[model samples]
Target: MPNGQGGYQPIFILSEGTRRQRGHEAQESNIQAAKTIGEAVRSTLGPRGMDKMLVDSLGDVIITNDGATIMDEMDIEHPAAKMIAEVAKTQEDEVGDGTTTAVVLAAKLLEEAGELLDQSIHPTVIASGYGMAAAKAQEFLNDMAVSISIDDEEQLKQVAKTAMTGKKVEANVPVLAGLAVKAVKQVAEETEEGYEVDLDNISIEKQVGEGVDNTFMVTGIILDKERVHPGMPKSVENAKIALINAAMEVKETESDSEIRVSSPEELQKFLDQEENEFREMVAKIKEIGANVVICQKGIDDMAQHFLSKEGIFAIRRAKKSDMKKLARATGGKIITDIEDMTIDDLGKAGLVEERKISGENMIFVEECENPKAVSVLVRGGTEHIVEEAKRSFEDAVSVVAKSIESGKIVAGGGATEVELSMKISDYADSIGGKEALAVRAFANAVESIARSLAENAGLDTIDTIVELRAKHEEDGAVYGLDAHDGEVKDMMSEGVVEPLLVKTQAVSSGSEAAVMVLRIDDVIASKGNEVGEGGGPEGMPGGMY
Candidate 1:
């Protein structure tokens, strides 16, 4: 080993078996791990991206096209891969639709950087240059973005249509498009002054079992159906509503004096007295017009039978909060005592309904004065599908809301960002300093997002990147480069801007996996002695950074 103080270190002098390695190798490994993870999902990129069926150890299945969901479910042990996962999560959490895109872009940027390194381009330098180019590219793309008036519904539709293309509901494009527009408009109108539309609010939930086809406004509880007992009421109407957090009947009362029941006659007398007392309580409720009852807990069979005979509509097993809501909604009182029940205490029955539409079940409630705030109980066919649909709907709603709130959607999926990075890189050689490297790094980051998305969606990041680059060259434009009309014309003459996401995530996860693997170098491990830690040296356990 070379002495720390100086000259060339002799490899032969060092113990080759030692695990310690160079920082460069570690960095390389991190980069490679990132690439490998990205490549795993490459083929599923773009509108035509493929779906993944994830079956867990329990044989539970999840079929989805969402990049984040897929990545999250995978049993990944690599730290770098986890970092890439974090990026996807960030995109999903922030924009709701760019997970795959971000991953693909990141992978491509890394791959390109690797090639540059092979050509003697320092990673630091390339990173810096990419940053500069990305900034310029962002400015250009921003400049190119066509701003429309707030009332331009057509333009908004165009944006949404672009996103919805080839999606599950593509067949209902016209309907969805109109709904999206309407939803956006509605959100905009309801928002406070200067409030923007948030598309996250526009989500879809599917359900099974008589589905949500017959949805209708409900002013009261939906457990109208009778309980599994003859004592249960068939229906209740024009009755007072009482919410009970406790049991309706009186608790078992101990006799103040212990009576000796040595004979059968004495026992019969006690039973008769108890029965009579119960009947008397039921009579009192009937007299008070307390025909409708909403209990947070269960009702005794005797009480149920009495209520049913009185034509009282009773709903037991109501949630405490929901029961309170019903009370508030109908200006009714909550009673815990069976004896306190009275005819006048009963409130009129509120309305409730359910419906199904578009293969989804919906439960609507009209308990609130503001109809817009009514809860829409969305149901799904399966847990996974339902969850994915919910996520998709949430994204749609959020995007719509945001577009309304901001008056427009920002060019997303880091498309605008990558373009900006590239343009900044174009002039990197002229500016000499750490700034150049920073610029390059920033550009790589932006591009990395695209590569990540492609990889997650199972597309060819390299080919896609190349295609994007070629399109820019042919059009005299760049991925994130935006130009004025004249500049656009020049670019057209030169051949530059080309839409690329569609082709990137359309490959195979294995291809993306391969690309990512090719980029690996260093492997960092943990230092803790956790039980599940894959047996390895501290800070060098699994395929992490």
Candidate 2:
């Protein structure tokens, strides 16, 4: 250590063997980690991108290239890398698609900032400039956004199809996309702010056995359970459904109690009383005119028998979330107490039935007058295929819902990114300062998505960018790469569409992440208290420092 007085004392701020990185060293380390994470998911960007097969310690495997899923499943140890993952998560949560674009764009922003840092530009300046560029890019996005409505079924289907394009569900994109649109339209409600959707109102259930073509949306709800007893009718028409949060079993004392019975008659009395309570519960349900019961808690064996003898179809131990959806779908009230039940609390459905598929029984409640909540059942030939199809369908549904709610959309297939790049680059010239360099860097980083799309499609990257730029210059800003043919074409006319929220959210999330990483000029990790090796704190980039 050195001081102006030509003398200094060694600082002992951290514990023994603590790992520390400072100044350029720390910034580079963090930036490199961000880049590493970005590149990890880069190849999964477009229709032709590749999928990853991730296996865990227990030998369970996941195969997909969805950016948010990949980042979640990865065993990331770097604190900075986790920050990068948050970018993907935010994109997924906010807009449901374009996670790879957000992540790689964030990484490229950091990589560009690293160059500025080398040339003596302040990190805050770079962050501020990037922020300004991002805001302007959003303006360009909104100005170019096309209005969409719930009735715009064709465009909505295109949005869903674009989302499912590269996820190994291409063969069934048209069918699954229709299901996504229908599901979203069913759950979407018009609000003063726009159409507001509660995706919880839509449930997705996946079963392994049938081909993906069998995937379909249910008019009502699906419970992944069966009848409590086989003696009960397997199907009930004109079903009066009761959604119960309370258990049908006899209530046990909450505390310990002692009962001393000197004779067998006394014990028999206790048993009769318990049996009568079960009979009373079943009788109460019947009195309320509920032919079908869905319980959130366990039903005792005695109670199940009574329910079956009464010709009532009942399911026990249903999930609380499922009960909520059922209430929404059937227009029933979730009764917390059996004693408080009444006919008014019962909901009506055309039919309630139990069906077996893939060697398991499931209950379906359908044909409600107008269900507020709906369900989609995804089926495939195998577990892995079904799981992946479920993911693809979910992404499609999410984007369509967002589009319906926001009432705004943009051309997909990298068209928006290329236009955004050109707009931001021109805006950088007007700022005219050291910050201008950072702004230009922002332009380049935003273009990484288009580049990745081209590269993944096996097109020449240099030629692709050159032609895209020329097209934008020629006032054909909506023209983008058609990955299927390696040609520049109009994305909007080609039926490639995405929700505007996806692009703006990606820009905002990616820039914020890049700024957070850029401003971190130091990293201090405490040492691990091990007997032998140099294992640092829980999140020390796996000892990379």
TM-scores, one per candidate: 0.59, 0.95
| lDDT (Cα) of model 1 | 0.50
Worst 10 residues of 2 by lDDT: 529-538
Q: Provide the global lDDT of candidate 2 against the true structure.
A: 0.89
RMSD to the native, candidate 1? 9.7
Q: Candidate 1 on 12-47: residue-level lDDT in tens?
A: 533444343244565555566566666666656545
Report the Cα lDDT for residue 457, model 2.
99
Show model 1 residue runs off by greater than 4 Å. 1-22, 108-164, 173-193, 196-205, 209-350, 354-369, 374-388, 411-422, 426-430, 434-438, 441-545
* Residue clash pairs of candidate 2: none
| Position 442, candidate 2: lDDT | 96
Among the numbered candidates, top TM-score falls to 2
